[model samples]
Target: MGCLSEESPSRSMKPFVFTWNGALALIVKVSIQPCVTLFSHPKEMASSSSSSSSSSDIGVILNELTCPVCSELYKEPTALPCGHSFCRVCIEKSWENREEDTGYVCLNCREIFAQKPKLKKNVIVANLVENMKLKEGKVWLEVEVQDTEHGDVNVKEAMKSGGSESFCELCNGEAAKRCVPCDILCCEKHLKPHQQKGHKLVDPGVKIEELRCIEHGKPILLYCKDDESLMCVTCTGGEHQDHKIVGVEIAHAELKDVLAAKYPHVSQSMQSVASQLRQVQKEEEKTENSSRDAEDSLEEKGRLVCQFVNESVDLMKSEINKRKMEKLSLLGKQREKLEQQMEDLRQRKSTMDTALQDLEAISFLQDSKDLLKRLETMSDFKSVKRTPLPVLDFSKEENNLDGLIMLNKNFLEKIQKGPVEHPEKVAEGPVEHPEKVELDQNNLRRLYGRSPSLDPNSAHRRIKISRDLRTATRTGTENQYRKHPDRFDDFLQVVSRDCFSSGRHYWEVDVRSSRRWVIGICSNSMGRKGVESGLGGNPESWCLFKGNNEFTAHHNSRATDLSLPGDPKRFGFFLDCEVGELTCFGDSRVLHVFWGNSMDPVKPAIGVYDGSVHFVHLVK
Candidate 1:
């Protein structure tokens, strides 16, 4: 019985024990299952998580590291030996900033770098950075899940219940519906297309890598003209033959540098030229001012000289008037004295005529007495005695009367001549005639008798008014002062006192060394037939020979004589000779000839009023 009863309880305890062991085993299995599975896929899980986390960290780092120069994510980043990475432009700018220094210092590493840094390109790094940035901006869809009071709705079920939609972040295209099963947002058109066509989509967390030239792999731009090929140094010469290829960063940098370098020089040169132009303008202004001042000074001096000359002319006119008044007074006094002398001569002539008539009557009575004596002796004797008695006293009175008549006649003749020599001298002389009561018979007859009567017709008659005298009288007043003014008189006085009309009546001097010759004729017109007959009528006619040697005979007579020590050729006469000398110094192989009405050898005529003629011989 006991054995049977123990078996029954054991069976029931066994069911309970099995249930407890199963429960513990499930817990153990749940904990240890994870450990066992972790070992089996350890490398795979670690690799997946590390890659995802590294990618996320890398995206954050790249987003933070922007190029300072271009203010963008590094497109073509280059790594320096100092462990710092920068866009090519950022490094180049830092390098240029220290151009005056020995070297550049890295902004990140604080390391002194070479002045010419090795600007190596890291295309792989640049591409990775670009891919990370693209992944951050990838388009995605968002669907909101509605939770009910019962519980949170199933995302997949919600999408299946018309919650699925599509959205494009690039163009802001939003989904209007949701796919419950796919848990995607989609519009009406995209919903069908995404489900049916299974469109390829980029993961929002994935990044795109930056592309570089396939040939060079150095982040340079490929020139389209070069067949769209990338070029390294080798390709640059071969595949890129004549390509318009460029290192993108360097091309842009060079453009900026060129503009900066050239502008300043051009601006400085323009400023320098402008300053020089201003200086020149200032100098010109000063020079013009000086010229104006000089012109004004010259004008002032000219005016002063003109004023002085006008004042001098006025003084000369005043002096001339004073001299004219003095000359008129002297002429008036001389006219008065001449009239008185003429009256005195007329009174003496009348007395002489009366005395001559008395003598004639006495002579007639004596002739009658002789005739009557023969007829009647007694009557004739009485008449003859009466006439003799008158004659006896008639001789004394007749002699006195005859002397007075002769004296009166001579005084009258002197009065007829122009004005008497000196009125003062005549007034001082005795006016009364000499009283001779008993004149000698011979003296009385000599005084009364006339020497002879002048013949009315004479062979060599005196010229009443010759042509030369008439011409001199006609123009005398107008030309008198001009021909011999006080100035000319002074000049003549000096010349005449110092020089003589070289007695060489007609002489010519050949001053060849002085290129001149002087010929002259001296004349004195004091004789009966003077120099006026030989050398024209005036003394100045001799001056006609002053120029050249050509002579002409006109009116009365003409002659010419030329003498030379040597012969001459091609002779000509010059008519204008105002100044300077005439020379005959030329080749001596010629002759000058002349002929006139008179062939008489020129004789030297000498007189007090002689003039000279001169001839000038000019040398060739």
Candidate 2:
């Protein structure tokens, strides 16, 4: 705490100040207090220099170079005509502090200049101070000892971790720190010169290679965006001219933002996938439990059905087991696909974790490209679905074969509802229903009416099909249709139940009470939206149109006005697919004939406007 002992090691090392322009460059060699000395008399300095000078003698000479005014090492030392010297800037400071500039007596000679002495660097003294400091540094630097607290420096691990210091290159011995500007390691003994200005010292634990540019051998202080590589200042103009470069800290901050912005999307995806996996796990568990419950229920109920029918119990069990085997076979295939997808997702999760753990900026972004592409295939990974297992259908009363099971009309329903009550008594022969739809007097209704039901699923949302499904009415307001790839979203046309490819088919649409109507056969590939969707006008449609008592038949969007005598109450539409021919009759008289080339099956379609049109089917 007080002045160090005169015999202390600090006395051997003195301040060696060098001026770069006018800066007072000081290199401190002592770990404790500095033994900076005041300027002494000539005889005292002579006595101090009496000893035989060695390589370390520069220390004594440098100590004597301290400024007479400031009592510190010479910094920008200047001389007056009186043969006395002081630091140029220090003398001015002294004059200002004492407010004695006009009497400006030299601190050593007590002689005043006519005015303030012109201040110029004492070049000779500056050079001597620098050369002596260099000698002194080399002499003392050869004797420094390493601190024992930390273990031997690891150059390799230090390089990998990135900082500054490691082992010295000269002797392969441990060092205390690294000089960044030199990009070299120095032991405590050879580190003094590196501790001065124009050099940067960093902790010895840092890696040398990571901080220096490989080509220029300079510290990587900036990032080069054009090359996606780290670089040094010299790289911007030399190798990467015109390329985008930013400070390493700035680039790191921006790239961190780029990665952070994707976090929400990645987190949501993980949550969604995890939820789906949990659902699959629950489904597997439910299936296992369901199988056990089903076996128990069937065993209980099989006894009742077998006893009542007087059938061999073993035969009935064999049939049930056969059906169960068939269903299990299907479920097995589905499960195989599901498990494969699950394994794939697991692998993707592992890849994601590895990518996240990689701290290297280059590698992390590079690996993410492949990861993103892999994610594309996972968008449709659902394959665990299985059809509901079949159960005994008891809806067919009295013809039940106790020893066998058949997939019947309500087989799916029974699975959902549990087995229906066993039929009252399995009847011996099948009962026939004599009920039939009445035909026209000419036996024509059977040909035209498969009960021409409009498919509501395919109709536009604005259209309201009748309860019996024979009529389609459109509300005037144009509205959006339910989303479907096949449904017409822009037009008002409805399709029928069946198509005929090679038969001559006849049907009658009665539009006597309608203001505007269309009856036609539409190709299966007709466009459902836009101008091309209109009945009788599109290339895929042919229709007979009635508007304001005018009749016209259109094919390929071109209309041919029919010269009928009057509006026909019922228009007879006939299509012969084998010849690609269509004919229409008004009042039983041939009115028009349209020809098409393809022999593909076609469905009859109808559209109405302003009033309703009826599909003329016979009632008994």
lDDT tens readout by residue for model 2, 73-180: 567778777655677765664444233224565655456665766777777666545543433343222212121333433323332343323556433447677766
Q: Could you tell me which 10 consecutive residues in candidate 2 have the lowest summed lDDT? A: 430-439
Residue-wise lDDT of candidate 1 within 1-620, one digit each (tens)?
A: 01112122321011111111111110000111110001112344345432211111211232234432233456588877865566776566445433343366554435675556677877655643443332234322222222222143332233345322244211113554433212234444444433432222333222211223355333332232336443332244454544554433334565578888988998999999999999989989988998898689759866874775466456555555655666656555655555555555455455445444656666756654653443333221111111111112345435544654554454455458643332223222111322321222233234322111111111011111122211001111222232211111211110111112211111122222221122222222211234443332332222212224332211123333333444332222211011111111123211221111121122111111112211222221
Clashing pairs in 2: 159-207, 163-206, 163-207, 164-206, 165-204, 398-426, 398-427
Query: Per model, how many backbone clashes are there?
Result: 30, 7
lDDT, model 1, position 85: 66
Q: Which candidate number maximizes TM-score?
A: 2
Give candidate 2 misplaced runs (Cα > 4 Å).
1-166, 169-179, 186-507, 511-545, 552-569, 572-615
